[model samples]
Target: MFNGEISASSLQQISPVSFAYIGDAVYELYIRTNFLLPSKKISDYHHKVVEKVRAESQASYLQNLYPLLTEIELNWVRRGRNSVNKSPRRLPLQTYQQATGLETLLGYLYICDRPRLEYLLSQIKIY
Candidate 1:
């Protein structure tokens, strides 16, 4: 829902973790919107969304995005990757870092370049 209301410089000052916090919501919303089932199987939809939204899945998405990202986007990824100090014990640190990087990039684009974010999200190969 965020558009050009905020200036680029102001967006730059937001922390990667803050961006990721919002990005996690935004991405989950997107997945829920696009992947919802017409049937009454709520659990099925939940499982599918969980599969796609997990840290490992996000890390895979980030890996696929690397070749397509602009330098500015890559810089945001690096910022997010470097910002992680710890992760849950169940997940490898690198996977969490990469997932955070994806979230950061998504959040940045959502605020500063909505069309770009939509394009990237559409490019994702979702079942």
Candidate 2:
């Protein structure tokens, strides 16, 4: 677990892909914790988690957050989007890029600004 101890300069040195890597895990834990009930079957939990974490779902979440992002936040997203060089075969390139952008931004906030990350995650429509 990151303690948010990294300096701003150091944070900048971290690659967008690296951010996306952490973001993917962070977002998954968040969704599983906040959105799912433990009473549900294990299979049900897996399906719901999968639905929320998919590229298409992530892209939509990014679109919803666009109007609310600050210039700095948008910059992080652009860095993530532009950093994408490859994507899974089943997904469209644009959708995968957008999803990566969202993940990158989430990862950035997770590392550099927990308050903002919580705010953005709260805004996500998971239902």
TM-score of each: 0.92, 0.95
- Kindly list the per-residue Cα lDDT of model 1 for residues 37-106, writing each as its tens digit: 5764888889989999999999998898899899999998999999997999999999999999999999
Clashes of 1: 0
| C-alpha lDDT values of all predictions | 0.88, 0.92
lDDT for model 2: 0.92
User: Which candidate leads the pack in lDDT?
Assistant: 2
Identify the candidate with maximal TM-score: 2
* RMSD in angstroms between candidate 2 and the native structure over all alpha carbons: 1.2
Q: After superposition on all CA atoms, how large is the RMSD of candidate 1? A: 1.4
What are the per-residue Cα lDDT tens digits for candidate 2 across 1-127?
A: 6788998789778999999999898899998997566478888888999999999999999999999999999998999999987889999989999999999999999988999999999999999
Where is model 1 poorest over a 10-residue stretch in terms of lDDT? Answer: 1-10
